[model samples]
Target chain A: GESVGLHLPTLSVQEGDNSIINCAYSNSASDYFIWYKQESGKGPQFIIDIRSNMDKRQGQRVTVLLNKTVKHLSLQIAATQPGDSAVYFCAEGSTSNDYKLSFGAGTTVTVRA
Target chain B: IAGITQAPTSQILAAGRRMTLRCTQDMRHNAMYWYRQDLGLGLRLIHYSNTAGTTGKGEVPDGYSVSRANTDDFPLTLASAVPSQTSVYFCASSVAAGVGEQFFGPGTRLTVL
Candidate 1:
């Protein structure tokens, strides 16, 4: 079955450092992708998104890079802070499924002070 | 705006019991979705509604049902809950299906004992 997956289950970054979380997807038909941050006891919140046509997209303190050839995606956080610690998930969406999203097993990012 | 609202932040139910998770969106989006988040599985789509009065099954829709009676609500029902159904359930809405961003609600955590 087509699925989205992450490279690591957990990541630790020192405060003021940069953090990167990697993900790989199995479906070539996926045209849209998104990154979400889920804090403890809270629902996932949108971080950034990119379309298949584009390779990268940037938000306030986050950047999402998509490598269609390798079916890979990554989210990079700049100047990691304590508030940035959370479970990060990458999701894929395709026209075939009406753009419905399929999420990947998350990567928990912990910002160490 | 209360982008999305879910009922009963948490629950503990015996197996074979029936449960209904209510979701409401104030954004008036045309697309609504139900997803379950497990420890290692990430978020899996359970059901979706593109508009009022229409619904569709998602990747893991078994043992679950949903209805979109109006533009503001989409409720997910479990006929006979099982232990395997214990997870955090989330409701999200988008301006339209297959495009744009999705706003999520505070999830409902269910434990089927």
Candidate 2:
């Protein structure tokens, strides 16, 4: 079965630095991808999303890039802050499957002051 | 507007016991989802409802059930919990099936001992 997965399990970044998380998916039919941030003791929150039609999308201090050829997706956070420390997950979905999303294992990000 | 709300922040239950986790969203979204978060496993969908009366099984639906009695609520029930059922459960709602962003609830932490 096709799945979504992250390249790294953990990432430590200095405050004010840029952070990037990578994800790989196996389903070529997937057209919608989303990034979520999960803080301790809380549910995952929507960060940003990009569709297969576009290569990239930008949000508040965050950007999502999609590479359909490689089935790869990434989330970049600018000026990393301590508040940004959390577990990040990438999910993929397709309209064919009623938009049911398949989520990656997750990448835990830690910011140093 | 209190996007989503879940009951019982945490719980510890013995094996064979039954439990129901509550979830509600004021957004009146048309789609609701239940997912379980485990160490190294990220989030796995258990069940989903496209609308008030329609339901579907997801990746890990065994031992769990869900009901969408109305637009504002989607509750997940565990029939005879087991040790493997110990995990954090998150409830989410989207504007419509396969159409928009998903808003998640805080989550319910369940430990089946």
Candidate 3:
């Protein structure tokens, strides 16, 4: 399944439930992708990152899945907490290029207790 | 240490007024970027500097200009403010270019009247 911005786009999960946020990268040339979490009245923070060579990577309780064939990326948060509620942005980076990061519109996550 | 701090956290400016959003990074990163985030549209790159003393345009660079005079500062200036330029501006930097994660600042919210 592809995680375009508009397909099953918005996900709502109760507190403590696992949450999955998805994104689709358009450029096959992108070799690096990063997930950033932006909370209210704050800036985006690096959550986790994965290279195109790897399909899955984990950090703490967060996991990032990359599918190159379909050009998809997904972030899974285990035991999603209330503090996890924020907009998540996925940015794609190209190795051959300097420092151009193509960012998505961002997905707003709401956690309900 | 202040990871990254933006001046005038929020501003209200009149049309045709000139405003400069200051971004200072203490990380001593070689690369820095400026992006503007709109409501529906994703974060669009305005300008970027791979290293100090050089700059380049990004996806959207028409209304913005940037200067990387030194290693720690990258400021974005709007010659003449316009309503279309009203959006949240973010400053980000990465330890390395090509393939690496980026750390972002708190962001500046600008509203042009």
Off by over 4 Å in 3: A1-8
Model 2 lDDT, residue B70, Cα: 94
lDDT per residue as tens, model 3, A66-103: 99998889999999999999888888877776748888
- Model 2 chain A weakest 10-residue run by lDDT: A40-49
Measured on C-alpha atoms, candidate 2 has an lDDT of: 0.94
Q: Distance (Å) between predicted and true CA of A83, model 1? A: 0.6
Over 4 Å off in model 1, which ranges? none
Give the docking tier of candidate 1: high
Cα lDDT tens digits, model 1, A1-113, are 89999999999999999999999999999999999999999989988899999999989988999999999999999999999999999999998888889999999999999
At residue B20, what lDDT does model 1 achieve?
97
Q: For candidate 2, write residues B5-111 as lDDT tens digits.
A: 99889999999999999999999899999999999998999999999988999999999999988999999999899999999999999999887899999899999
* Top candidate (DockQ): 1
Residue pair clashes in candidate 1: none
Task: Report per-candidate DockQ.
Answer: 0.90, 0.87, 0.80
TM-score of each candidate's B chain against the true B chain: 0.97, 0.97, 0.96
**Candidate 2: pairs in clash:** none
| Model 3 Cα lDDT, one tens digit per residue, B1-113 | 57788888999999999999999999889889998988766678899998999999888899899999999999999999999999999998877675366778889999999
Fraction of native A-B contacts kept, per candidate: 0.90, 0.80, 0.88
